[model samples]
Structure formats: structure tokens, C-alpha cells
Target: MNALSQTHSQGVVMTQAYLEIRDLVKSYDGKQQAVRGISLDIRKGEFVSFLGPSGSGKTTTLMMVAGFEMPTSGSILLGGREIAPVPAHKRNIGMVFQNYALFPHMTALENVGFPLRMRKTPAAEIARRAAEALDMVGLAAFGGRHPREMSGGQQQRVALARALVFGPDVLLLDEPLGALDKNLREQMQVEIKRIHRELGITTIYVTHDQSEAMTMSDRIAVFSQGVVEQFAPPLDIYQRPTTRFVGSFIGDSNFLDVTRQNDGLVAQGIGALNIAAPSQAGKFHGLVRPEAIGLWTGGDEQGHCVLSFLIEGLVHYGDSVLLIGSAAGLNLRARLPSVQASHLHEGDTIRIAWRENDMHLIPVQ
Candidate 1:
């Protein structure tokens, strides 16, 4: 059974998802499909991020799930029952946006109480719950301050409190922290994770920021042209990307276009040995993560695999240094800890090598 089906059987018991999308499809033009039949099962209390660049159809799919846009095909199962036609307010989904979306005229307290008021909650109870929500967001002292009176970060916290005041089972965020500066964004990312852990509410977050997605998602749905290219844990997406797009998206990588050779693909400058490349290996794409390549030492030394290179450039990255080199006519990059890189300098002749398993072979799609 799907996440929605399993969630509804227990009802109000705080089960996950209770919401799912099956073969969901959407299109703006009749001839061109935007979201091409996406399916997802979100468990209760899990945090999922739908991530991709602009035009990837991630936002469009998010709108459909939130009931703002209707899907052209397929079903939306809410608690195991179809809610494709369900009205927005009835879905009971909490939302926070990049703009903070707070009422400029109202104090944080009143702004947070808006949802409770709309639901006809008693005045006293509304105040009580709103204050609690503010407290949860570490903004209890800012309750009486209006949006204009608070800093951007404080306003964001107020927006978060407002979203949570309704106690919605699922929280939907649309680039909610995008407006913050780098340090603030990092701080809010931590805050958001902490909140998700504490509340245990299933969440759907959308963003184009890879670092944000990596730092917070329980599972990341990497989208490409409106389709999910990969959905996996952060490490898997970073170290074992299943596709070329994923390899380029999660982090920096060195790509070598190769042809099938014996048991492994033969890269231009680097020869190959036995390595169980992915099923799609023969098509001509090989991936080497920056960290996988290490300084090479030549000898007749035969082990896994090795490549000779001339170091062309080096970049310092605080904790590590990135070295750029050319191997067998292909450009390659290696990331080494600064401590280890301290001994190396420009134009150094180095042999870079990695285990056969360290390389990834990608399909031509």
C-alpha cells in the first residue's frame, strides 16, 4: 500500500504522508507535457525536497500537490482516498515562502494567530497557541513586534511560527530561506531541520540550492525537465549518482567520455581494468569525484588503476585544495585536504590514481 493508504488507517494518530501522488502529469500546452507522470510515496514525519533548477517543473508539481494547480492526469491520494478535487484550505497543509509573507500591519503574535482565527478558534485559545508557536521558533520576545520592526531573520522566524500555529500535518516550503544571506541561510537550514525533527511532520520543500537540499532532506528528489532523475540519500546522490545530471548536480566531478574496453570502460589518458560499471556504461560517460583521485606514484606498480597527469592549477577551499590536471587528453580534478596539499605546488608532475570502483559510468540519456 502507498503512504497515504497506510497513514489514513490510523487517523489523527500522526502517521506520515497520508498524502501521495501517483503517475501525476501536468502540462501548460496540450502538446507539451511539463510534469511527466511523477509518483512519490512520502512517509509520515519524513522531510523530502523536490530539487532542481528553474524550468525543471519542480515548482509546477509542487503547486499541483498543494491543490493550487490541477493535474492533467493521474490521482492525488490523501489518506488513501483521492483528493484531486479537494479545496486548498481543506487540505490542512501549512506553508512558508521565500518572502516571509507576514502581514506588515500586524504584530508577530497576531500574524501567527491568523490561521487559528480563520478556523474560528476562540480568541483566548488563538493567543495561547500563537504564543506557543512563536516560542517554538525562538521568537517569543518578538511576538508584539510587527514585521517592519524585525530583522529579516526574525521576520522569517515569525513566518515559520505562523505556518506552524495551525499544527498542520504537512509543511510545504517554497524556497522559504532563499532570501537570507549565506550565514543566515545556513543558520535557518539548521533551524528548519531541528523543527522538522521536533514536530515530526511530513514536509515537502522545493529549492534549486544543492547545498540546502543536501544538508536537510531525508531523501532528495533530483528533478530534471520536470522529471525525477534520482531520489536517494545525500551520500548516494553525491558518491554514487545514478545519472549524469545527478553527478553534475550534487557536486563537482571530472567526466571522461570513454568506450567499452574489456571489463571496464577505457578513458583516453587512463587505461582501465576490471570494474563492474553501471548497466549503462558502454554509452560513453565516466565520472570521477574530485576526492576520489589521489596523488599518483609511478613504478610498474600494478594495483587497481592509475593515471599520469601534469598538475595545471590548484584552488584552496578552506579545508581542502582542488587540483586541476590533464590525464590522457581529458581534464580531471582532484580534491585533497589542505594539510596533504601543503607539499604540492603548481606545475608539479603527479600521478593520480583511484580504485576501479571509485569511477562511475553514466548512461547517455
Candidate 2:
């Protein structure tokens, strides 16, 4: 389902759409469509993310919204007005590309004030607004420095300042932090979120990074093969995904083919499951997150599924340990706290259990 349909189906009472994309489609070749009929209603000041792997139509959709690419079919409405005919610059939409895109010779202040100057704002006002914009991105003291003189993160801050100085109606960020190192990228994520909260501007961010989208967006649209697989809040997307693709895409997951038999659910390889049956009694793809499974100590197995896990591989992430193993002829991945898995090693057999309610059921497609 599209974003709007999914939201309405869930009984979510949303405010009027400030940015409406109705059946937006983009085709590079006359016969091959890059973006399918995708529709979404974004509320005013809401921060949404278009998330997917490379060439999944997320960027294409963002470009259409930015007026960089015209849609092959359907309409784009910004604040209840059609913006398809509007040129990119005249749309009053601020955009920050993957590359910082700051002028090498221009000072940070000059770069930030470029948009204002293009609009023919007075010199004094441009200078004041540029300084304020740099200050907002925590680059006030670096205004005199050129892009070449700054770090990747600082250059990114300048780009952000440039986008915000004009006070555009909406902001579109296309992987602005992709060039930064891990530590810097994380720092910029926090900074961007703080600025979003401060400005309260309607924003759409496009990224292939799942963690970035999960932590940054108010809602996320998961794109796949030119279509949105799912669009929802971060927690909902992770814990209760509507499709198997969404369940596997957002986080670490294990899928089990299950079917109803004699008033109970049974997995294909494993026997009868203790989990609650879904409302629909039919074939399903049972989604179990790795974190939901725990080491089975001596206790009641009521309302839980216990298995003997044979460890095949182990990966340590300092705080946690990921165990890749097989159980009941099914390959599974289980993540445990480092402290709990201290003695565990490859080729070891251990007891693992997961609560019945922790498993989410997705209809087979």
C-alpha cells in the first residue's frame, strides 16, 4: 500500500497534507519506469525520510519533488498548490545534495548568503541572515573560512546553512552526511535533528542508510523496485512491519514460513508454534527479530519457543555478540549481550528461547 492509504487504514487521524505526492511516477525511458505510482501526504513541519537501497527510486522521487526531474505522471502539491510547473529555484525548496556542493573559493558566510543574494536581498540583511544561519548550524565562528579549509563535517554545516538562509518553504536533504566519517556522521545526525526541531520546517530526507532514517525521521517510506514497500514510524517499521521485505530491510530478522493447522500455527521446518495466531488463518511469514531471542536458562518454557542452537559463526561488537547458527534445520541469527555470551564460542551448542508474543506475522505474498 502507498503511504496515505496505509496511514488511513491504520486509523491514524492526520492533519491536512502540506505536501501531497499523488501517484508520482518517473520514467527514464519511455517504457521503463524508475518510480511507480507512489503517493504520500506529509504534514506541515513533519520530517520524513525516503529510505532504500541504491537505485530503489528514493532519489528519483526526491528529485521529482525538488523539480529537478518532472514526473512522468501524477501531481505534486505543496501546501495544497500544484508545483510541477514551478522551476526548481522558484519552488522555494531548499536542497542539500550528497556532495556538500559548497563553492571552493567562497567563504562560509558567502556560501550561506548566495541564495539570499540570488533573490536580491539587501546586502545588510543577507549578511545578518547568513551569520544567523551559520550560527544555527554551529558554524558561526568558521564563517570566514572557505570550504577547502574546513573538515567534511564543517563543509556540510556550511551547505546546511546555505540551504536554510533563504527560509525556504520546505527542506530536502539527499544524504548530506554520506561524505562524513562515522563519528562525524553521527554528530551531524544529532545536529540536523536539533536544527529541524528548532526550525520546525517540513523536511524530506533521502538516504539508503537504515539507521540514519530510523533515528532521524518522524516517518519513513521504504522504497523497493520503484515502489514504497512500507511507510510508517520507525518503531512500527522495525517491530510490526506490514511486509516481509520491510521486516528484513529495517533491521536484523529471521523469517519462518508458517501455516495454520488444527487451530494452531506450525512452522515449515519446526513443529507447532506457541505464538498467537494472526487474525487471518492462512499462510504467513513469521518475523522474529534477533534481539527478541534470549539464552534459555532453566525456567518454565510457557509462552515461549525454545530451541537448541548450534553455533556456526560468531561476531563480537564489544557491547553485544551475534551468533549465526541453525536450529531445527532453520538458520537463525541471535544477538546477545557480550556479558551474557562471554563463554560462548563457535561450534558450541546452546539453548535459546524467544517469547511467543515477540514474533510478528506478515502475510505471505
Candidate 3:
């Protein structure tokens, strides 16, 4: 028996952690680390996403949790017991990859039943359970179709079914929707979120796409340079990012370098601004979300930071319009509803204002 199975056998009452990762570090050649001392505690049914750019250690951390990569130092506790020493097969963790990894010759039913069959399940039980799994993924009618006979989206559903067929303790997905087109990718994102809600299984999804992570995950761990820069709910990560990298990564933001003045904070071109945040006297970055900026329609500008925007370009996104402009030596992007932007055009100088609190601060490093 593995450590987890042995822990269950010992009848010791363990903590309520469905999954726990503590101080995980992965180093190659003992010089540089891929995952540097990251820790997270996941509840029994929490849906968490590891979001970051390529080679930012999100995938490396997921691999460590799935037992595909060994951590140099740390503990992965599943069901309140350490599973780092357990073999991949013994860990009871299911994984779905980007390529789908289905057998070309085997039908969807056979593919979904492969895991149960490997565990020496009865033929009758495998057939029944496989059908149920396919039904769960809305693919009951496509069970007899082989991988070559199915579309990319259908094949991905089959892969998801196969992963969930055995009712594993945890599910790990590594960029599973990357192969589909934009429309299909969006459709799959909804499907995955629905399945996650229904199953309520502890899941860790790895993706470089911020939209995908924000749409599906209950909470996101933003990875950068082998560290988790911020881990919070999607809206929290989006609205109040703690770092400059996170602010730039998650959404369209204008970061203005501000200097602390005797009265308050000031930017080079925008003059005196209302800064309610307290910080040391030094340089800091003010994060201005694009949506927070709107056209200044002859208001008093009291309690708000108003600036003159020299419009450079415009992008129409059907429902919204993106205004790319410059203000006070800072290039800014502002998103306005199409209705509001209809009267505006390129090269028009307009006043733009954002709330004082909307400007979040990240100290310059």
C-alpha cells in the first residue's frame, strides 16, 4: 500500500485537506529551480487554476502534484496524507492533456473503459460505468466512434470522460482546450465548467490563457518566475492585483509611474492626482484598469483623477470600443461601451477620468 492507502488503513483521524501542497520546489542540476517553494491548500471540491506564461513553472508544479515530476523538497498531501513518494498509478489522480491522448483504433467506449479494465474490473461493470461516464460528458451517442471518426471537441469530451470514469480523487488538466478553434474553445470552456460544478471534484487546471482561467476557476494561482505572485478569486485577481506583472498579465491596464509629492502623488503629464493610499515616499506604479477610465463629459473632476487623452487609435469589439490614447506621457487604453464611443473618433482630444480608489499601487522595485 502507498502512504495514502496506508494512512487510511491505520485508522488515524487526519485533517480535512482534500489536497495540500506545501513548500514545493523543483530544481534542475541544483542550480536553478523550476518551482520555487510554493504552497497551497485545496479543499475537497475546490476548482483551482494554475495560470501563467510558458515556462513559468505552472506546468512543472502541476506535474509534481500529478506525480509525473518529483519535487526536490516539499510534500503533497492528498486526503490528509503525504503522496509524494507514491507512484503515479497508486496516487489515484486523473489527468487530461491538450492532445486528447486517445487510442486511434479504440472506440470511445473502449477508451473510457481502459482505466477500469487496467484495474481488473469486471467486464459487465466496465461497460455500465463507461456508458455512465460518457453520458456525464454528453457523449453517450458517440461511444462507438473511434478517435479518428470524431471531431476535436468530441475527442476532448471522450478524454474527459476517460479521466472521470474511475472517479479519481483529483483531476488535473494541462491546456486541454488549446487544440480547438476559438468558438469551440469557448464552448468547451462552458462544458468543462459545468462538468466541474456537477462533479465537485478537487481539480487543478494549468493554462497560460488568462480568460480560460478566469472563466472556470473558483480561484486562480497566478504564477510568475517560478513563484505564485497572487492567488485569489478571479475578480480579485483582476481588480486588485498585488504586483505589476499580475496587473499587466490578467487584463489591459495602464501602469503610470508616479512620484510622491509633498501634498500627494503626481504623474508627469497628469498634474495633481487624488491618492488615498498610504505608502512610503518613493516611486510607485499606479494601475489604471482600462474600464475604469471613461470619457470626461464636462464634470467637476472633484474626487477623481482627470487627464487629457490624445486619442491615437480605436478598436471596435462589437459591444465595446477600445480607445488607445496618450496622457501625461503615459500611453493608456480605455474601454467604453459602443454606444458611448459612437460620437468619438480618432485624433479627438477628450478628457478621461478614473476614480481615486481605482488607481491601485504597487511599489516600484
Expressed as tens digits, the lDDT of each residue in 142-242 for candidate 3 is 99999999999999999998988877788899999999999999999998887776666778999999999999999999999999999999999998898
Candidate 3: where is the Cα deviation over 4 Å? 1-17, 279-281
* After superposition, candidate 2 runs with Cα above 4 Å error: 1-17
Candidate 1 residues lying further than 4 Å off, grouped into runs, are 1-16, 262-264, 277-281, 298-300
**Candidates in descending TM-score order:** 2, 3, 1
* Cα error, candidate 3, residue 50 (Å): 0.8
145-254 per-residue lDDT for model 2 (tens digits)? 99889998899989988987876778899988898899999999999998877666789999999999999999999999999998899999999999888999888999
Write the number of the candidate with greater TM-score, choosing between 1 and 2.
2
RMSD vs true structure, all candidates: 4.1, 6.1, 4.4
Question: How do the candidates rank by lDDT, highest first?
Answer: 2, 3, 1
User: Could you tell me which residue pairs clash in candidate 1?
Assistant: 16-44, 56-226, 269-328, 296-351
Position 314, candidate 2: lDDT: 93
Worst 10 residues of 2 by lDDT: 3-12
lDDT of residue 76 for candidate 2: 96
Quote model 3's TM-score: 0.93
lDDT of 1 by residue, 1-365 (tens): 32322333234474334668899999888878899989888777778999999989888888887878899998888667677898878887888888998989999999999999999999998988888888878887888888999999899988888887777767889988888899999998999898777667788899999988998998999999979998888888888788888999888998877677656666656666466555654666678888887776656545446767778999999899999888778788899999989988889977778776777777777
Estimate the TM-score for candidate 1: 0.92
